[model samples]
Target chain A: MNPLAEIVAITAVCVLSGCLGSLLGLGGGTFVVPILTLAFGLDMRLAIGASVISVVAGSAAASPRYLDEGFANLRVAVALEVATVSGAIAGALLAGHLSTRALYTVFGVVLAVSAVQMLRHRQDRDGLAVPDDPIADALSLHGTGTGTTVRDIRPYRVTRTATGLTMMTAAGAISGLLGIGSGAMKVPAMDLAMRLPIKVSTATSNLMIGVTGAASAVVYLQRGDVVPLLAGAVALGTVVGARIGSRLLAVVPAGALRVIFLVVLLIVSVQMLLRGLA
Target chain B: MKAAPGAPEAGARQVALVLRIGGGLGAALVLAGLAVSFAESGGGWLHGSGVDPLGGDATMRLSDLIGGLRHGRAGAIVLLGAIVLAATPAAGVVTAGYTWLRARRAWLAGVAVVVLLLLVLAATLGATE
Candidate 1:
């Protein structure tokens, strides 16, 4: 492929990936990696590296909009990040030693289970219940979501801080090992376990993914897996795509968002299972 | 309990500002690098066999980056941009933690500090390995 054509193709692909990523509060890497490697015939390591960078770029670009719209819970993000970062470190260290096939199977099963739980807990009313976790209470993890109008403002209390944090560690570890955002894991944990609204879960997940992606990104950088021209094209695409996605998120109804999340979840779950089995 | 009026908004605005700066600069540098590469290559930027310009390892060091910059290597400029982009989230975290501290949200601030430390530890461990 010609240089201009290749760059344009990558940017275009990443634009769609970034849009979906921001909309789903994912890092956009899950889509970017396979597309870059399979379609463009790029190196796997370089694709992962560029995908990681795209994740960071998408997260950073979309988060401000989420924050402005009051969907991203800062307190929640800060609290859970500790576990995610720790898990990422451990996962990075454990990377080469473990069989990725086994890891994929485990992650796939986890995603399937979480998808079921998320479906079972589709009722968003749980957000209004008094949270039982003292840690969450003390940290002020509860917040009001400003979805569309004054009527759309829903105040929510966070529950099961321990469970959520535990899941976050797993999410981060997966992120480190796979060089993906692990938002599929995170959204379920937050929505089902922590009882956050789906929008809140998605937005908060967006806020934390950049930090999580960064944990492993530096290693990729030092390893020289990151090719500048490709990564640059990807980063540019994500910035634009994430901007468009964030704007859309502000108006998308919570029910629609939940449905979108679940569909994406099942697709990712199936993909993971297929990879593991293959 | 309701948050102080505009406190969250204020902090959010500040963090958003930082994000905009970082993302904007990173994107700009990337664009500039691509343009420079195209110009330098005289529009046949994809030429040459046995070397994938968009793939392979380009292990960069501080001094190497400096030298590359002096010689107008587009790869160096783009790499620098990517590094800056990678660092942006950490900077955003610091800003968030600082804002929390300023608001006297001690627990939130503490959590932020721990998260930051863990990130640094991950990088350090990754480097060692």
Candidate 2:
């Protein structure tokens, strides 16, 4: 494809993915990578490099809004960053040694799993009204209060911090290997295992994912896997797309948004699987 | 509850202009650095020693040192741009958080965040490549 045309196509995919990802509280990179690799026929390593750039862009574009809204708990995010950053470094290092074929197969499976989870967890119900543990209190896992639009911010406690950290480490490893944001796993682990409310988990995950991507991105940079032209294009596209997606949240109905999210996940999952098998 | 109207509007316009100039300059510097390195690497003729404008790398026995500088410069420029890009989202969260803390104009802040995110996404995507 012509360079300009390729950019335009990738930008379209980035915008669509960001819009749905934001709505579903999933990181846009999850969707962006599959599309770039499968649909565009880009190499997995290159796709990963490009995906990291997009993740950084999307996270940066979305972070301010979440922080402004008091939805992001900086203290909680910072604490989690320790785990995420460490995990990211490990994962990134591992990625360099993995075979491309193995990476694609694993990525395809992860995508399918993510799609199922999104489909299964359709309703946005408030979690346990109050956190009931020491870990939650120490980490400030509880929500302050609910918003007018989203309802009351429910406080959640970490039932098993070790478990959550382990999952995060695994997620980080996958992120490095595949170049996906791994937010799909992080948010759920935080929300369900750590017992954080959905919104808090989502925002906090967004904050941490960037650090994870950064750790892994450095590995790619050293390996010369990241093409400057491709990274630049994807990053530029994702930032703009994430901005639009964030804005559209207000007007779009939450239910409809969830459906869109599921559809995108399903499509991307299939695409990845096909690409891997091919 | 309207702003002393014109004053707020003027301030808003000023902020917009600042953001525009900041974003444009940032993108330009990033692109230029990348182009220069691409040139020096013999990656292509448009940016190589044959037509080298940035002489540091393209024409030097100290080519390794110049190459290192180019790589470092490109990395720094890209990192800064990424941070600036990420700030838009952080700003939204901050704005919303502040409004919630203040207990006023919460909806306005929410709407602003959504708008800002979309605008950033559109502009970034549109400008790709």
Candidate 3:
């Protein structure tokens, strides 16, 4: 591939992925990795490497904005980090050993699962729901998330603390293993299971994904899977795209977009699965 | 149990600051590096250029990648960017960890410490191995 063309291709991929990721409140790595592998024809490991950096870049671009707006729950994110970090390290180490076929299969399965979860997500009822769990009480997870343009400061309680942590552990492992930020898993665990607002879940997931990627990034770097130029293109593209997506969030309805991305992901996953089997 | 009125905001700001700086710097360095590669080497970046991204060379180490940034090679700059990109999250861990520790939140601090250590260990092992 011509270096310029490669850069252009990757940058374009990240931009699209980043924009959609931010708009849907999902991180870019999920989309970026598959696109890098199936469409761009990068090796699975290489794609994973670039995906991690792009994930970090996307998170960096959006975390501050989300945090300032009071969407991410810091305490919840912190507590959950325990599971993700540990799981991520293990997953990172594991990815090094897994065959390319295994990675593709895993990636396909993950994307399919995530797409389904996204489809099933329903906006929680609007109310002042106080958390009844002791852990929530201890951590003070009940609080108000300052709204974006379309919403207001919504007060809510986080429940099923143990479940959230456990699910996050799985999400982290998947992230490290596949090199995709497990925002798909994190959002559902928080929004559906723990019963937090989707906005808060997504924001916190965005922040946590960076840390999760960092955990695996070390392994990828050490293992020499993260190609500098490729990762660079992804990082730059995702950062730029995420910024644009965040701004567009106020007016764009993401529900329909989510359906479209899910379909795209499903098709890509099938191709990826065939590629893996081949 | 509510936190102080401004505490969460302050903490969020601090974390946000770390992310913005790390990400922005990383992006700038990477872009600058690509430009320099083109300028000095004549479309070097547009072809099979930028240091080989594979192999066990010690030069690829994080510390060395940062060290190379002083010489102004585009590849080094990109590597430095990657390092910076990777480090942003670690910085977040430290910021959150230290803050929670000061507040006597042992669990949060402990989680942060463990994560930070793992990252350092990954970098260290990658460097040595």
TM (chain A) per model? 0.85, 0.88, 0.94
The residue-by-residue lDDT of candidate 1 on A199-250, one tens digit each, is 7888899989988988877777755557888888888898889888888775
Between candidates 2 and 3, the one scoring higher on DockQ is 3
Ranking by DockQ: 1, 3, 2
Residue range A37-153, candidate 3, lDDT tens digits: 777677788888878878888888888777765667877887787788778887888888899999998888888888788677585456645458888777666767634334455
Scanning candidate 2 chain A in windows of ten residues, the lowest lDDT window is: A139-148
What DockQ, on C-alphas, does every prediction get? 0.45, 0.07, 0.37
Candidate 2 wrongly placed segments (more than 4 Å) = A122-131, A145-148, A151-159, B1-129
Q: Which docking band does candidate 1 fall into?
A: acceptable
Fraction of native contacts under 8 Å reproduced by each candidate: 0.53, 0.04, 0.47
Query: What tens-digit string does per-residue lDDT give for candidate 2 at A90-121?
Result: 66667767777777778879977876766675
Instruction: Give the runs in model 1 whose Cα sits over 4 Å from its true position.
Output: A96-121, A124-128, A146-150, A253-278, B1-10, B46-50, B57-64
Better candidate by DockQ, 1 or 3: 1
Report how far off residue B18 is in candidate 1 (Å). 1.0
Query: Per TM-score, what order, best first?
Result: 3, 1, 2
What's the TM-score of every candidate structure? Answer: 0.87, 0.70, 0.88
Candidate 1 lDDT by residue in tens digits, B1-129: 121211244377778788888878888887888788767763464564434567575445323567778898998898778877778888888998999899999988898899888878867766676
Error of 3 at A34 (Å): 1.8
Of candidates 3 and 1, the better by TM-score:
3
